[model samples]
Target: MTKLLITLLSFCFIQCQGQTKKNETDEEKKTRQEAIIKEHVYDCADKIHYTTQMYEYQKCLDEGIKKDSTIAYLWQQKAMPYYKARKYSVGKPFLDKAVQYDEKRWLSYRAFMKCIFSKDYKGVIEDFETCIKKYGNSYEMDHTYSFYIGLSYLQLNEFEKAAKIFKQDIEEQSQRLGEGHFLDLFYYGISKYEQQKWEEAIVQFDKSLQQYPEFSDAEFYKAICLMRMGKKEEASLLLVKAKKDVEKGYTINEDNAIYETYPYKVRW
Candidate 1:
């Protein structure tokens, strides 16, 4: 541990020791100590964000990990820059350690990275399935666990499974949050499009567009569906609009889309 961390922890111990109450219960004392440690960890973490140098950042995380090897956030912090830089192989070991320390918190995030950054669709499916079994259909990075599973199945060309999972996710979200996310609806449409179910795909694409007006991927795919159904004139008009919207930067706006292309995100 660094001298600064050592000193801060020592000061916290001394301060907490001085605050002990005569009638304090064992659980109360434990809670108090945990709070002090958490605050000290946050204080150490605050300094990490001020530096952009990778070595310095990793060094800071190393110090915190040394102080408490059980804290998963330190390991995750150490791994993020590597993944963001497309160095997934270099980052995976650190991320695995984070998962080891806190599976519930970091497993879904690791699955998300595997889905988007590493292109490990099988691994993504396995990790997300594990997450769903343990946590029961949760959200990670703004999408449901099933959403990533659906995306992974799409990448693996398992369109039927992808569409099934997407439909379940849409229904669950509709019941829980009043509506499904636009990307969920859009990707469901892509699954239908892949299956060449033109009319069914068009219905999903239209619903997605209702949620996100001028969503280029939905518009583009809907136009393709129209053309497939022999509505050539209407398809041509919508295709032109889709191309113009995409040109104006109206594409997948997910935060990680800045780092990697999402599955089926239209570029043209």
Candidate 2:
């Protein structure tokens, strides 16, 4: 960790020295600053660890970014430590630059950082909607984008809106992902369950369990649907199977509702 810290410090020193170029144009100066900021950011990123030294290293990158404020990716680099620490309060302001500059190939995957880490579901939906409205269909090509939006709506108890998006994705895909992602089906099932459509929710859960056989949560949800619809025997059997899965330590999305808590694991 000490070596990594020294390496990043040395990189910053080198950049400060190099920026003293003679008779550089204004644009050239900006470009040079951007390059220097990126250098320090990458150096810090490479050295990141769960250590105090690494936090100091990241703070070094953040300072460089703040000093060279025009560079979008620099701000993103500033946010790296916060993202890793699940500290969205400190990170989101920095990530704002990546969004503003449209250097967002990775940011597209990460809007959920706000939803999962900040409990900012409404903000997530509004931001995605605004961006998607501006960028249109191309902005939402990734399945995860749709999932996050729908899941946020679910969190808000807005079942109809959530169902609209999930149904579109599930029904419109060109090819099946064999059984498909369990969370995809799970969220869709949840939308139905929230709407009190017991039979439909059970069908979705059944399809999920068919593909993701060991998904205890899916079985548990299915049991709930059956129990709701007065199929006590069937519900009891499914609940027993789900209990065994829990005892054997299976896990899935929508388990503890921590994403609603404004602090979360980076992944769903």
Clashes of each: 0, 0
Please, what is the TM-score per model?
0.83, 0.72
Worst 10 residues of 1 by lDDT: 32-41
Candidate 1 lDDT by residue in tens digits, 152-234:
99999999999999999999999998989999999999999999999999989998899888798899999999999999999
Error of 2 at 244 (Å): 2.6
lDDT for 267 (candidate 2):
25
- Can you list the residue pairs that collide in candidate 1? none
Runs in model 1 with CA error above 4 Å? Answer: 1-52
- Maximum-lDDT candidate: 1
List candidate 2 segments past 4 Å from native. 1-38, 83-86, 103-110, 134-142, 174-180, 247-249, 253-268
The local distance difference test score of each candidate is 0.87, 0.68
Lowest lDDT sum, 10 consecutive residues, model 2, at 259-268
